[model samples]
Target: MSLKVDKASMAFTFKGGMLPMTVMELTSADPERIRDQLAGKLNQSPAFFQHTPVVLSVEKLDEPHLSLERICAVCRAHKLLPVAVRGGAEPVKQSAWALGLGWFPPADGARSRTLEEVPTSDMPEESPAAAAPQAEAGAGRIYRGTVRSGQQVSAPEGDLVIIGAVNAGAEVLAAGSVHVYGALRGRALAGIHGDTRAGIFCRELRAELLSVAGNYKRLEDIDPQLLGTSVQVILSDAQLGITALD
Candidate 1:
């Protein structure tokens, strides 16, 4: 008689939780240069990039035909795990997949914001840090330029604050909260680590996507009148709440 045995896979429950991830946006096709720069940056801030999970972003490059394998190799050499590739041409994406890489599109029309086109406002002077969302009171990444399409800024430790517009196809993610002093046209995700009190604040509520904690809402779900106006997004009872920030 044969005894039935239960497989270990059946006993495991795969629950999902959010974690901080780093994205290496490649503007050049030179693998050596990238490797060198990354090495230097890592040396300066060893703790920040130590064994960090990285995603390769090649959408902003003039030439997307970079050697995916070489990039991956360099990442592995420096203890950076390359898990996925986002925003590249079809051929480039295909090559990455062949090298055992996953493909992810820019979340909510995410695009890269270049320094050439910046937002200008005639409003009273306010520091970038002051414009940031105040939630868990911790150090947050202060971005000074526009968040363009396919560009993403993530503050894994605390919150994220942008002094300029977040154009369509861009994303700003934070572990605590997100604040934008200008138009928010892309995506903003707060409380990525599941803090229910996380929130999103923007000067102009033109976002295509917004999320607090695990609750999410698309542009269509928001009131049309709220567009292009100051707004705040929060999570209440596992639901997304939008309100004007007076």
Candidate 2:
């Protein structure tokens, strides 16, 4: 007879926390009005709105007017998923629960405002009379956690932030800027689409390789003195430079 070995223990491994979901602030008084606005924006840039998941913030909406079913239906019509509801009145919270949507309270010290009260300048500017709209720089998201070896994080639409160590054999890729709050000993590639303006920030820079867009700097290319120091890497005038963080 053969003895049984505990092979299950060897096959299981624990990882860090779950990835955070993106939250979008609705900040609109009339759900129909906001829907129209979003539709118009998407019509102008269909590619930008496609496949982008978002949650709604209804703090700006009054308590008795809007219902959760109506909001979810509107979101579905726009191809946006309403995974969580935020910033609404008590009735709004109840409506969200009725519609099977998670209700998340606003963070502490966060200010609440009405749609009419909020300045519309924060919204993207629209063009008129055959004039073209200006292209805006893409926004980036930051993650504050350790990336273990054999782990990977990728951001295709925007930049990514990591506030933890990137252990050996781990990889991080972003289409925009990449900032690591801790050590970076793994591989990181930024500006994956030739943005060139993308950069890397780390407290301890000892990576095997670093790249921005198509340009790269290998470990052998950097000076030994620059290793293991807090630094910011940028591409200036087609050359990569490491500078001390202020």
Candidate 3:
């Protein structure tokens, strides 16, 4: 029994791909203020943010001299796990590395389109496309309550509208378009049947996932600034485009 050890060893492989992660942009150096704002945001949908992994962005900070540990601690207090820091100088990076926090390369703005640059005409038109087959004259669905976890609503006819929140773990699907008068924190799929011009609109753009036509975007891929803003999501050039509403 003392000499019966197996000699086979397992090999490890690494596969790389883009991951959508939440980015918490900091505009203030005060930890207390950060806590308060974060708390308010979490309150809107606690289950969604609870224990969520996030990356910190200091690009907007005027006095970015606060302790990195303090920032991470505040995030932890609000149930957000701070995994990395972005857009900081060498000193901040050094501190974050020392504290075992990962560093994320700053995103390039030149290659990306600004939210305002998106055209308003990109929104899914209520009327059917000239070349696409049309739905029944008035086929659509309207819901008036919070779509809780495990709940799903699908409108196979034309459109879907919810007057309440689409909570985390919930889902909404539509053949034409999806509109949510309240917060959208769950999954939304429009043009499920391949309507290339389909769209998704929501009062609060906090959805964990979104899709228009066949283009899909996860929470991390979305701009953090659009979290609480009224937004319209559309598919352009096979890419998901998000535009803030007036």
Candidate 4:
């Protein structure tokens, strides 16, 4: 006559959200140097840099040395989308605003802490199946480029291939598969049209959120074992699985 009891812990459900933006500091003293850097990078990978969004950081610029207007014009001429300005002096900030660019303070305690300070455990994670279907069959565009933060690429016809890093705060949407040759530290959506067969492949798995069709998966729900040097994401039987690519 013995009594036994069993206890089971409940598994928590989480949703993945937007990845934070990666900062690219431009501290060159000479404007030509900055232009040359951009040109070299673009020349090396035209597809990767074309139409990518970027934030300008001018905190290091000396007074009357370089103007924000000039910087914005240079960025535009190089096909780089200037979306915001950060860590710049007052004049630079004002210039950015006048150029129709968004402005934000540098990542400080009063403003916002850097990504390192923010705990990863607190990030959002959700299943790809839970999202609302935003794509239709054979609807969307295919983009071959490096997706930086403040930039978004969407296709209604096919998949998207990013030859470079999908930095945080950037987004990639496709009606089919998504391939990232570089680190995927941003949000990527595949099978946007409810095609559960679409998948995502990345060289580095550091994305904030991953979604397929209407489902999504968050970071917290991801098993530590699945996070590795390379990863592949797939949806089968309405379930999303992250597995080693190799």
- By lDDT, the best candidate is 1
9-58 in candidate 4: lDDT tens per residue?
A: 54665788853553446767466777889887554324334465777766
| Predicted candidate 3 versus true structure: per-residue lDDT over 1-246, tens digit per residue | 386635465365478975545566677878888888888755433444557677787866655465778878988988889888887778888887898989876666541222223233542343232112212336887765566544567787799977767877677888889999888988888887778788999999998888777577889989999988999998878888999999
Compared with the true structure, model 4 gives a TM-score of 0.45
Model 4: residues with Cα > 4 Å off, grouped in runs: 1-145
Q: lDDT for model 4, on a 0 to 1 scale? A: 0.66
Alpha-carbon error at 137 in model 4, in Å?
18
- Look at candidate 1 and tell me the lDDT of residue 179: 89
lDDT of 1 by residue, 38-104 (tens): 8875543343344656788887776657788888898888888898998777888899889888998
Answer with 2 or 3, whichever has the higher TM-score.
3
In model 3, the worst 10-residue window by lDDT is 126-135
RMSD of 4: 16.7
lDDT of 1 at 39: 85
Candidate 2 residue-wise lDDT, 112-148, digit = tens: 3322232444322332311222222346665545565
TM-scores, all models, native as reference: 0.50, 0.43, 0.48, 0.45
Compared with the true structure, the alpha-carbon lDDT of candidate 3 equals 0.74
Candidate 4 Cα deviation (angstroms), residue 33: 43
